[model samples]
Target: MTPMNPDADAVERAVARLTAALDEGRPVAPVRDLIGEHDLAAAYAVQRELTRRRLAGGAVVTGRKIGLTSPAVQRQLGVDQPDFGVLFADMDVSAEAEVPSWRLLQPKAEAEIAFVLKEDLADGDLDAARVRSAVDYAVAALEIVDSRIADWDIRLTDTVADNASSGLYVLAERRLGLDEFEPRETTMRMYADDVPVSEGAGSACLGDPLNALAWLARTALEFGDPLRAGQVVLSGALGPMVPAPPGTRIRAEISSLGEVTATFSEKSGKPEKRDA
Candidate 1:
């Protein structure tokens, strides 16, 4: 019989804990205790297992989302680097007239620049210049980030294991090429119920959104999963994220990329009780 690897076993337990929280339609304690507060690899292991399960259940890989690109946020989370999470087909709520409230636990909204790639970043050194040429277009995006950890009391490992606290994303219809506008210079303002709540510029996101993409490309390549063509990449938040409670209408305007909005339904996604 093959001996069970303790670290691998810990990862499994962490996955199970998170999966249970998701299935129960509620938040749970942070998974950092199980995977260690600083074990990024173990945290990612849990995320990968969750992704595998989602794929097995027929979810398609649409793209990826970068998290913690803001220096302030990194400081808040006590992590010096950014993290990433998979973007699945179902996670795209762009077409929904009103976003379902129950689809998330505790969600916050942030504005971002979404990049749709035209070429693979699998070959050659993926510098900023190389990554820029691969972009097919850019769009304004609103990301509804959710946390499965209770009260969002999370360390870096906790959020990383919980798919970088991803929930749903909405992209603007307007698209722009690199030559049309410089990403680093774009400004952003987000509104909740038409009241301005958050604001920042493109430089808030890892100096530039393109830099975030470049980092993701290099990181993904190192992990043996180089970014591919036609994948949508949410390059990280351009400003602070605000609470997105049920029935709230959120909108974000990017100076050059245009604006995107999402109106959440009033009802929460509370699971119904079932007979044992």
Candidate 2:
């Protein structure tokens, strides 16, 4: 185990507060005032601690998700680069499953490409080509992001500490080999219900989703965690995220990839009794 940082107590407190908010299914005020200002390193430290706690609680780490890679998203968040969050097995909502809106604080949906790696990518000097070589295949994905910060008011540090505002993800079953589709050229059309909400090309994600993946590969290693084989990596958003409300069915079709769907509904107290 690595030595705990001097601000370990603060990190722990932040983790506790955020975890409680998540556990109780409620939003909390941003922790910036509580943890001090613009401490990116400390924010990441809090994230690491939070991940440790979640892992201890039987949450299996399945993959990672990159955020704020698109120019529009970056501009919206006022960030220059991308942020990432750890993905756990429990976070994987099946494409056919109906998500419970009440379980999430403030949910929104973004279309993305998910890369499944066949080999470990640990090099800090990784480039897009090297990144592509490690990818086994790519699938269409929908990232349902929820922020714990009240009213979605957050800064870079606030979000990093809040696990990149990750909530749930649904991945399409179809897999396309790297050669089968160009990540930069692929286009995505997102729909809320049957109406189009947003559309964008893969290039919108830092010129290419692979580029964002490369950035994540390098960044993860710097944080002492490396991207390993068999882990899915969400390569950021291809378009603007649409508000995901209860009873709304969302879908995204990626050119040459396939379509993925997510439906949000109110959670029921009990399973409906079905007729024989």
Candidate 3:
């Protein structure tokens, strides 16, 4: 199918609708009809404009998050590759703080490894080894992914335009060096309210989380941004995501990397129905 060529006005309208939904904690209808199904380029442009608006509104870009690196997630979404989104300062949640569930729409939780870089990584020649060398440490993380697209009925273009369906994240307090830790060997088990719900190994993330990081480094450069020092990169999920609702406590324990927890509470209002 030939992609639709959108003008500046169309992109602006799409961005405005999405940003409003995000701010009001509501789900918006799929924008494919507005942006066109095959116009991924224009979808990404909309995402960039939204990011720019968020930055202008005082949200700092702390890092980036990779999505769909796991085969399980790819299969669930019927997609074959990964996409990414920028992480803002407000998206970082404390491990001990209670996440206001009412502030989100259709939230889900995934176990992941987060990389904090100590050195800048440029655009080209990014490999797992190169990516590993640039890391400061890796922490066990829980990524709470929420979608503005109602019912999470999103195509690749839909999600990419919606910031890869990214939401808030919680990182473990403890950090581990990569010298003794192997990304592929790390095992992860997630618990909801202390009951084990899902489990997987780091290899599920594109063979290794480092590979996901390398992919993000290369892809970010293509987007005119390099992996900067001190930026936290979410390498991707190690297992399936579990539904997270108000008053639920989700915890993730990673082999050698330590554990992280996210507790949700009813802060605003009940979650709106997102299923189509």
Can you give the TM-score per candidate against the true fold? Answer: 0.95, 0.92, 0.91
- lDDT (Cα, tens digit) per residue for candidate 1, span 12-49: 99999988887888899999889899888888888888
lDDT of 3: 0.85
Model 1 alpha-carbon miss at residue 43, Å: 0.5
lDDT of each: 0.90, 0.85, 0.85
Candidate 2 minimal-lDDT segment of 10 residues? 267-276
Error of 3 at 170 (Å): 0.4
- TM-score of candidate 2 relative to the true fold: 0.92
Q: Which ten residues in a row have the lowest lDDT in candidate 1?
A: 267-276
Q: Kindly provide the TM-score of model 1 when superposed on the true structure, using C-alpha atoms.
A: 0.95
Candidate 2: which pairs clash? Answer: none
Q: Write the per-residue lDDT of candidate 2 for residues 19-93, one digit (tens) a residue.
A: 778766678888887666567777888888888877776778888999889776677767688989999887788
lDDT of 2 at 144: 95
Error of 3 at 141 (Å): 0.3
